[model samples]
Target: MTKTAIIAGTGVLPGILADRLDETNTPYVIAELEGFAMENPKGRPVERFIVERLALLFDRFDDLGVEQVIFAGAVSRPAIDPERIDPKTATLLPVLLPAFQQGDDALLRAVIALFEDAGFSVVGVDSVAPELVPGEGVLTTAQPSQDDKADADRAAKVVAGIGALDVGQGAVVAQGLCLAIETLPGTAAMLRWVAEVAKTCRANPNGAKGVFFKAPKPGQERRIDLPAIGPDTVVQADAADLAGIVIEAGGVMLLDPEATIAEANSRGLFIWARTP
Candidate 1:
């Protein structure tokens, strides 16, 4: 019975993972990062830590007999405080400081390496909760029109292009016009901005609204920071007046599949898990 540590961050996914661990009666501890609040800790024992003292946290995990670690939920880059950098973390500053400039994928990879180098096996969300990744197909009764499909194709390519540069995991395309790309502000903000733009834009005269596409970055370290959507995403897309949502099959996580699909169906928006 090896113990595992859940490095919980902000969002429902961390809470959902906590629920799964509880149901299985798994031996685990939740480590909440500083700055990002953990959602619904489920009354579980949680330890708060900061990036400046990761080495100290590792020692704590060691004392707790934790052998594996899983990163779950959303986290933005924390503003580092030079005065608080522990001696151990300071030793690695040469390697970490450059990663901070190299984009998120690089930064995450570097962080994962730190955990792995510390002898803790890093596990992916897919490995811990396979149920969150839906199978391929349109999950809604409203099928995507040919035009909608075309828009999805365009959106997919756009997401891939941006992903290659570690730019974003999502893109919104309407009639082949890229409406928005997900950035540091995240998908919710991007969708809201698209909705604002749609009010004054009449670029899509063919009547096909658009598609919201999401996927993991090309060659991304899937063990952390995989793109995800939930019922809230469906509501946001509906607000943006988009035709539907598209995700890369096996590459994206649906936070609450039943509720997400039901929302899409209720709003007449299709959730397509397409193989790419």
Candidate 2:
């Protein structure tokens, strides 16, 4: 019997991967990371301490004879108060602390090392859900206006440059000015911040409200959190009156691609997936 374990990070990716594993008659166990939320507001996710979760995750894998581990979903890097770490996580803290504070890749690489050292083969979600990847084209029915396209192109360059520096994936741009950059608060919060700025800008004589672009890191770990967009993104952009959304082709994951495109079309929001 083929067995696998999904160490869930965040969002719908993990559950989707589990469904795929189920179809193949492979038994899989889910180990949800602490402090990450599912895409669905109504969904309840199992959360546990990192080390405790990893121990149980491996134990389940051992019990089920799981040979493959799909690292699907987003894991937020929170400011860990060393005093609060559990016994299991505390033991790993001395090493994990320095790498984690360095940057996203450094921390993730350490996480992968810890798992691989314990004999788990971690795989990317792309192996199971190719359809989720976007192609190079206008993803939404509403094609970008000339101005929207130019804005998107410019914004993409900005975000991509920021990504190369390991800063963040998303940026808010309007009228050639970058309004905000994504940080620990994440995309939705970034969008909301842009909306607030747009609201304020509405009163100004200049039409300077900005749209958003999300891209991948220069040499991103695909198995980890790839830039993600979905129906909620459309709703947020529409409600905020954002000009458009730009993402890297084959670099970002559109959760429920068809539905997201449909929502974008209905809301008259432009979505561009650009390629090299």
Candidate 3:
């Protein structure tokens, strides 16, 4: 039997992929890289391995007849210790450490290359679960006001330009004032900081505060680490006193899309999937 596995990290993407696999009755396993992956795969084989222990995991997958792999969810470059990994994996660490040190794109490309070098095909989640990609449009009834539209447009250009520098994928543009940009600290922190700043120097109190633009890095590989947001995203935006969010159409992951849209609607925040 041809075998495949979902290499789950930490987030809702893995579960979403798992559900899609189930609908097609596709048999597969879950390779849970330690320190990641939220919940255990309830109905399938779940093998655990530390992220640095690649050699052993590759051997294990080969033994289990696995031929394809899909990576989903979020993971940071953990501090790796040479003493902890098996000698076989240690030798290969030199090939990987640099990518980990680079940025998300380099690291992701390295991961895919590593798996392919191990004789396993690396595929994007879209290949296995196409339903998750959102169609292009404002996802909710709350539309961006003209000012908000201009801000969103500016944010999109700014983020895209910065993305080429491998800095980040999101930015906050409030009243033509570029408030914050995503950094190594990530989006939630970026938004939270914006909220704090807004509290100290508030907006007009009636005019739209700002909007966040998230999208794929210009000329970067897709499939891994597509921008993601959830219901709590609405809460964060509301707390930040922001106008809305704009994501690259078909480039962002909507975790629990229905609930997320509903939350955004209830909060009167615009959650749009626009062309980037």
Candidate 4:
């Protein structure tokens, strides 16, 4: 039977996408990244190397008849250690230097080329989770007020600008001001920052509450590391006592939409999709 595979980088995309394929009756395999800057579960099948080591991943793909591969997860750019690249990947070093030395975007594009050369078509996580793409409308019981929308707009611009510079794609906003942006510490930490700030705002009585906006970094590769939100985001927002959430329509992925939406509705959090 034809097969598919997931080249998991970080976060929950690898396993989530794999499960989606399974539901479609499509068999799949996962090649988790090893020794990269991100977390990896013990006993997972991971190969330690750079993008070029994908050549070997294709060997495994061929064995499973995996004609398509989805590159998912959250491996940060700085996590790659040059000394860890295997011999085959080492040889491709010269060709990759210009891009690798430049930025993660260029490096990922190079990796895409390697996979293409090996006869496997690379796609995004959206292929398996189309419903995860939010539409233009209120997605929760509550609605974003005009002021909240303004804050979300400002946060979106800031987050997208930061994404363009490869910083990150999420920002917290309240009353047209930015509270925090997702950095090396990750989104959860950033939300916590907003929560802290929200407490101060609430105490002031004249201040406004906060919300989070997650958008794609401008020019970020859609095939890899698309911004994702799930039930955890709602839980986090509730803990932060934030007012609502906004995400770019179709730009970010909802890891588990039904559960996430249900959680947001249950928590009285408003969710909207902004069009830009």
lDDT of 1 at 222: 88
| TM-score, structure 2 vs. true | 0.82
Per-residue lDDT tens digits for candidate 2, residues 10-122, read 66877777667767787766666667654534353443545433545555567767777777777766666655555765566667778867879777778777777668887
Write model 3 residue lDDT over 1-276, tens digit each, in one string.
Answer: 456788888877787888888888887788888788555456555688886689899999988889899888888777887678888888777779888878789988888888899999888777887656686888898998899888888899899888999999999888776888998899899889988875345356566688988888987778687778889878888899888999888888787788999999999999888886
| Clashes found in each candidate (C-alpha, N, C closer than 3 A) | 0, 2, 1, 2
Q: Rank the candidates by TM-score, best first.
A: 1, 3, 4, 2
Candidate 1 has its poorest 10 consecutive residues by lDDT at: 198-207
Candidate 4 pairs with clashing backbones: 10-73, 10-74
The ten-residue window of minimal lDDT in model 3 covers 198-207
The prediction achieving the highest TM-score against the true structure is 1
Off by over 4 Å in 2: 34-49, 52-56, 78-95, 199-210
* Model 1, backbone clash pairs (residues 3+ apart or across chains), number: 0
Which pairs of residues clash in candidate 3, taking residues 3 or more apart in a chain or in different chains? 9-37
What lDDT score is found at residue 141 in candidate 2? 70
| Candidate 4 C-alpha lDDT tens digits along 121-222 | 888877777887877888888998877787887888889788888777898877777767888788888887766764565434455566789988787778
Q: How many backbone clashes does candidate 4 have?
A: 2
For each candidate in the order shown, give its overall lDDT on alpha carbons: 0.88, 0.73, 0.83, 0.75
The predicted structure with the larger lDDT, 2 or 3, is 3
**What would you estimate as the lDDT of candidate 2?**
0.73
Candidate 3 vs 4: which has more lDDT: 3
